[model samples]
Target: MTAFRLEQALGHTFRDRDLLQLALTHRSFTSPHNERLEFLGDAILNAVIAHCLFERFPRLPEGDLSRLRANLVRQDSLHQLALALSLGDFLRLGEGEQKSGGQQRPSILADALEALFGALWLDAGFDVAGRVIVRVYAGVLDRLTSGQGIKDAKTRLQEYLQGARLALPQYSLAGTEGEAHAQQFRVACVIESLHLRTEGRGGSRRAAEQMAAERALESLESAHDFSRQPRS
Candidate 1:
């Protein structure tokens, strides 16, 4: 995957090829890397995403808009976009980092994707960069549900119980697995008032807790008579 291919996928041609090259160059590869561009791109990405969300959901409150923007610009979301563009194939990494599978790492891919956007902004302008970002994220934006922007799973679960004057959901580490660098965390989310528990696993404890909370919320929503029970 050359810069030309990336440009085609990104739907923007770079006036300055060096910018694109620098965007793909990881710090492990050389001194002139993508970190600075990543910084610039992070700000641009947030602004572009915020503007898009503001336009798309005119009736949404600021909190909802912020949550939606956060979800859209999260590392996982950016990594998915990077994978769709095959951005990793064009990354310039050092020999050790390349051998260690740095290309597939979500952090690296997300940062490089941001750097590419930064380069695009520099090569063209904010208008072009904004258009490209909206284009790349169109599918994601379209698939978003009305309930998505309200709150994240953990926050929603906590708020739901707190509204009823119930004890907040308790999260505990269930276990862990895999190697040091690639370990998986298992977290349990407990709702003792309802005598219900749900578990989730992810690459990080925070992620696992979020997954568990999502599952717990689903379980609560699906129960036929659970909400009718007395609050503790």
Candidate 2:
């Protein structure tokens, strides 16, 4: 989408367009990147979440509120939001970064989401950006309140093993298939010193690992007779 369209979607036109430009500029593209903006955005996001949580869950204690905020502002959550906005296409990256798929990197996308909010705050004000954040985070808020955003499958498995004093789960690629450009990876998850194992497939090693871990978690949960926890 065009910058104009993005601005329109954001419901604010930047008087200093450079702020918006800087928000789109990755570290690969410039000496002084959007790191500062990301920092500011982080604080702003926390404050906004805190305020919302305070009002939404007046009876909720500090710890629960903190957990809910953590769930709402996680890297994966921000990356999903960035994808919804198609923010990846607007990122200004160096040639190498562009070619190396920086646009699809969760870390990059998550930081960019924060930077965009920072830019909006700078261009308009906290009120404007806070509104945007609230709108974007509505689903997260709902999930948190309903206890559906706590302890995702991955975390549940980790905790289950940790409580048993077992070693952390290990992942290995079992095989690959298809053409060079269209390759798919098969990954296995194994618990040390046990025959328990499971495998899964995906388009990339990381994706394969995730799928494998998920499968492992499901298998363990079923074997251990543990109730499925909410995903965060």
Candidate 3:
């Protein structure tokens, strides 16, 4: 995939294409890889998420804000964002890593995303980078706000399923769109026992899963037939 396409997805064209190239360069790929950029990106991501949380939840205590930030910046979260960007297609992975499917791995994608953030900061400075970050996180932040509670819909749905002695819901990345900045993530939420399937779309996979879970829960609650209790 060309950097131009990824740049379009990011909604931020790099002034120095080298920085973007370096960000996508994996350690396994070559010398002067993105590890340093990854390190810097990690800091930038944390700070950006933290600031957003602080501003969004002024009444909430520091601990709560920290937890929210942690949730938003976790490896899985970053990986979802990377998936939204189809970033793996643009990664410069070594032959071995490529053969091993490292492109789709969570750690690699997350680290690459961080490296991209670092590259953005270097290329456009923190202010511009921060704007891009916020744009990418908008759906996630909006979901968090809608819930108001720390426990998301997926958590609540899982607990409900467990309490009912039913199998856990299955979530899969169904597909994604080539949208700008915050790409659309489509996910399928399925419960085999009930023969139920729900789809959701959001800016990130996590958000999409949560939305799917919420829909599943709603469907289950509204239609009492789904409440068939499992044998003890």
Candidate 4:
């Protein structure tokens, strides 16, 4: 798709044409790449999504809201949005990236989508970019609300890490407390790449693991940068 058509699809015309081009240009393409834009957009996207979830689901607790936001903003979700925009066709890639099919790569496409959001915010403001994000995610949000119960935290965490091609988190039995038959368990969830460790206490081993996973997921969503790939 041409840049003009992309603008039409995105529902925002850029005042700065160069910003739009920068957003679409991958690092491998040249200097002054989209990584910084991606970082800014990542923050804006998280804040916008958090606000949306908070307002849309008033009765939902913090953990559930975090889970929903994580699902919506994950690389796979952004990749789908990119594909819907026919975004790959418009990407400016280096020869190596182009030959390696970088346009279709989930990481690049997702980062580009975020960079586009960054561009939109710069061209206009949060109001415009937030609306476009909500619209782009409308179908996904609908499906999530249509009696799709919250996914298991452990499963959700695994999917999140896997989506970014990060190393799987390790869950270990830390210890136990209380007497026999009434003991509370402590589980530690560690993701080495992010240098993250979270602990959860529960009445059973599975419960403890799930709690740990939930905390870990929340930390990953709110604190860590999922855009970074682990070293080979």
Top candidate when judged by lDDT against the true structure: 1
- RMSD in angstroms, all models? 8.0, 8.6, 9.3, 16.2
Q: After superposition, how far is residue 20 of candidate 3 from its true place, in Å?
A: 0.4
Give the per-residue lDDT digits (tens) of candidate 2, residues 148-195. 345454565677677777788888889987656556678888987456
Tally clashes: model 4: 0
Q: CA shift at 221, candidate 3, in angstroms?
A: 18
Per-candidate TM-scores read 0.67, 0.65, 0.70, 0.63
How does each model score on lDDT? 0.82, 0.76, 0.82, 0.81
Clashing pairs in 2: none
Which parts of model 3 have CA positions greater than 4 angstroms off? 146-232
> Which candidate, 3 or 4, has the higher TM-score?
3
Per-residue lDDT over 1-232 for candidate 1, one digit per residue giving the tens place of the 0 to 100 score: 6678878888898889899999999999998999999999999999998998888888888988888888889986786678668788999999877766666566888999999889989999999999999999886676566546534568768877887788998999999876577666889999999898999765678867876887787788688333453454
Displacement of residue 45 (Cα, Å) in model 3 is 1.0
How do the residues 58-124 of candidate 3 rate in per-residue lDDT, one tens digit apiece?
A: 7888777877888888876787678778888999999877766667666788999999999999999
User: Candidate 2 vs candidate 4: which has greater lDDT?
Assistant: 4
Instruction: After superposing candidate 2 on the true structure, give the runs of residues whose Cα lies further than 4 Å from its correct spot.
Output: 146-232
Better of 1 and 3 by lDDT: 1
lDDT of candidate model 1 versus the reference? 0.82
